[model samples]
Target: MSLDSISLEAIRKELLDKFKDEKITNIIQTKKYKIIMEVKPNNFLVLNGINKKRDTFYIHISIDPSSMEIYFSESKNTEETISSPFLNLLQNHLIGGKILDIKQPDFDRILHFIIQPYLKFGQTQNQILIIEFMGKHGNMILLKENTMIEGSIKLVDSNINRYREILPGKFYISPPSQNKLNPLNVNRKDFFNIFYSLKDKSLNLWKLIQNNFIGISLQNAKEMVLQANLSLEKDVSNASQADLEMLWTSFNRIINNIKNHIFQPTIFLDPLSEKIKAYSLINSIQFPPCHKRNFKDANSCLESLFTELEKEREILSIQNKLDQILSKNMLKINNKINDYQKKLEEVKNCEKYKINGELIKANLASIKRGDTEIKVINYYSPRQEDITIPLNHKLTALENARLYFKKYKKTKDSWEIILEQLNNNQLKLAQLAEFHKLYKQYSNSLPNLLKIYNDLMKLGLSKKIIVPLKKQEKKKNKLLPAKYISQDGWEIYVGKNNHQNDFLTFKLASGNDIWLHPKNIQGAHVIIKNRGNKQSPPLETLIQAANLAAYFSKAKKENKVLVDYTLKKYVKKPKNAKPGMAIYSQEKSLLIKINLPEIKNMISQNSQGKILSP
Candidate 1:
């Protein structure tokens, strides 16, 4: 809903009324970087302006009883007391300047601060403070004696840039190619004409206001629309008689509601849920009336559920990434272990003759003298010049194999521990995947349950029947069963599902009442009481009852259907029978086509009593 011209006008009127009796007393900065002005009301502080052109322009203003100080990013480290150039200039002019009037350039667009006695410095006077905030674009302008002193601009000229100047010496100019709207010059008729030109109803009021005027948020536009009681779509130029009436009524109601309920928070709903809720309400008059669910609360629950699912998805993504890295590393480590084992085996298989040759080549005196039975020595060269040898009386190859086997055992032991950790991590990854699946199922089940309940309610069931279904239960059984009433006010029992069917035929129904069921089809078992009298059952009544059976049955779309009817006494529920499953004998079959509208009318009439209760 766009804020049309009419709504903007209303906002303009409101702002004018609010500030009519106020004056700017002090200016300060909010923690969020907004500029706030203290006015005469004393009870309220107006957010005077905002800095939008550059984030660097955020200046903190502190007000004390004795003096006011302004701090900017550049002055953070100065230990000596020094005034900000901008603050000093503003203070000198605005300290005692009496605000003569305040005007918005266009409704909530830009504010022109008109002050009398503009500060005189070296014969300069008539300084005015103009603050412009047009959403993405905003600036502050200072004018001394009608000539601009300095103003915020999108681009600084070379003269200003070279001199590092944003001061009173240079003249101020409006930004290039800026579309400015003067609100004071626009009248109601002009606004009406402009709004009427737009034909699209879906255009948001805030967006329209922002495009045509300036400086309006969606919240502010919505407030204006509420104040006007106006249909955001009603075009003044093309309104038909009916449209005019609707527009007028809506406008008046909205305005009155706003005036009565000032400062109340806005209520919003999910569109999808809202539509479903409406459908449920509309369809329930014909079917069993379902209980209404709070769509707002349901939407909130759904949002949280989705958010939790998203978080789980992110966690799963991280786990998968980690598992991939671990698997790659494990493969690399296993390959290294296998290669090292092969090298160790090669070392162990080294020939004893080669070792003996090395021992002879080293010329160890004991071996040469044959004093050690010509023992072979397994030797390792530490350097070209030195060799260390250990002689084994046994064959030299066996001794070398023993050393290689010892090294293999140590390396294998380390690898086994690493493999154990990998196996544990893989198990954890599988568990996480399972958890994600279960969470999704659980999240999905809630909406399905809600949909089923809503569908059932649209069938015209009373709250007495509907409320019990929402309760927690230990077993899958209905606390309250479905009951039907005959045209003569005789109570007839009908089963909703298999379990209820069993109960109705055996426990609830009388021996004399005729039982009804759609022949050879999945449907409710309906029993109509036989009022022992000469009067015959009206054809209409019989058809109505049959329609209920067919409507609730699998043969709902068949033009004609065979329904079995018999005494309740003939119907019997077997031991350990499932819901809606019952056996009966001595049944009479009647073929009749179902008339849904007539049955609905009958049910609706019967429900009047229940509806009037509260």
Candidate 2:
């Protein structure tokens, strides 16, 4: 949720107080939408306004559209930061600068940082950095002393916003004024009169208050409804005198809080979704038991809320991309499978051509070259049924028989080849489905996501997932499968991706080893190493390996799961098959009532610290 002007006002006051004794030390561009300014306390008299090591903090300004905010955080994480042209220009003018003053023009969602840069021995200079927190139109611009635009993080021309353009060499203009009445100045009489002056009384009271007030958001309006205990959906026309008085009292209370600076800086979280339900400098009320967090200042409150939001956004973006790539490739594969099946049906008619050829051969003496049709009986059918055959009158009966035999031979040959191709496509589709399950088990993981992204690149299904040149060499090494050890000390390995599965099944496993998998489910391939024992592993060892398979499958959450186990020698990779595809025989199924807690503990104890947790 984006901050309203009220919350921003509180944040501005909170930051201005802390920054009075501080100066900017550095400016870091953390991500596409966020920047960090390292600030610390300064001793202007002793060190030419250079900052000391004490009282250092970061001013984090974010313009992510979803959460446009500027707040002070205790520490800065420069791990993901990279340099940009704008960042370098900002550092040149902003570093070592002290905020001489901060302004909120017309009490809008904007901040003007008037800064004095570290100058030469006798010269003086100042710069203005304007940050606007308008949702979906947020921006940061550096301006000259006279408000001439120097640069901006985002560019808008006449086509984007005709009233004003933000570009280099243009005079910086303020945003258009929202000519709503200031809530801080409204009295009870003015409030009632304003409501009555609007001829349309059919408006909802909650929306009416928001439409007529400056710096008040929808959350503010909803909070008024809760505090006044009035009907939340009541229209102005339906409201009694008592309801209007209650709303006036509720509205007056929040305005007084703003005037007195009695802020709560609260974040209310929905219990079910565990996400921020509402954020304001004033307390919020929500239904079904919300978790309320109160902070000493608005800056801390916003920092905590948006950190969770940013993480959620990053994961969602990756997931949507994975879905898009898979959807495109899966659709292509399904179309091929459909076409092959249709061709198979046409070739299945080869038996009829063979029957016609045999019947013509049996009746060759009775048929003449001028005959157009013939019926033969007492031949191929046990009951001697008659079969009608259409003939080419210009050709001899013997020649017609030869043509039929040739057509039968050609169709039968095509049937064998196309059947193999169709089977391979079906097997590849199944392998992809299994790989999707493994991917979801670590959807929030960066390493797993990159590994899967690399896998897709190899399969030629994803070209848009870019890998940096620096990491290209490291990506050449394949990701190892998840490894574990059984109670009997047999090493077990589970493959998290198709390539890893192929390596585990054929390259790493011995012919006498035991293999286990979840039955009819998308999951990992697990192998229990025999380690040259040359004998069968105990039943308990088999169960432990089977448990690993069930835990990693799509059915991991089920109370009861079925697992299939077989010898490695029985598994054979089909010709022209995908990396993970295999045909196996002599398999046995294990029905398990899963002990989820036990399985989790076992994983933590035996997994060799390689499980990629989401």
Top model by TM-score, which number?
2
Model 2 Cα shift for residue 449 (angstroms):
5.9
**TM-scores of the models, in the given order?**
0.30, 0.69
| Model 1 weakest lDDT span, ten residues long | 275-284
> Candidate 2: deviation at residue 601, Å?
16
lDDT of residue 198 for candidate 1: 68
The per-candidate count of clashes, in order, stands at 23, 0
The residue-by-residue lDDT of candidate 2 on 1-614, one tens digit each, is 76777877787777788786468998998777678988888753345677445657888898878667677877656345778767887998888888888877666778888888777565665789998988788889999898888888888999999998999999999888787877877888889997779888988898898888877788788888778887778888999889989999988988788777778887777776666777677866644434777888777788887776665665576678778877777788899899999999999989888999998998899889989889888476779888789888988999999988999999999999999999998987876775576568667555566667667777777667544222432443355677777788777888866777898898888888898888888777999888876588878878888888888778988988899889999999999998888878899999977767766777777647365211
Q: Score each candidate by Cα lDDT.
A: 0.47, 0.79
lDDT of 1 by residue, 68-105 (tens): 22222222221113334454455556644555555554
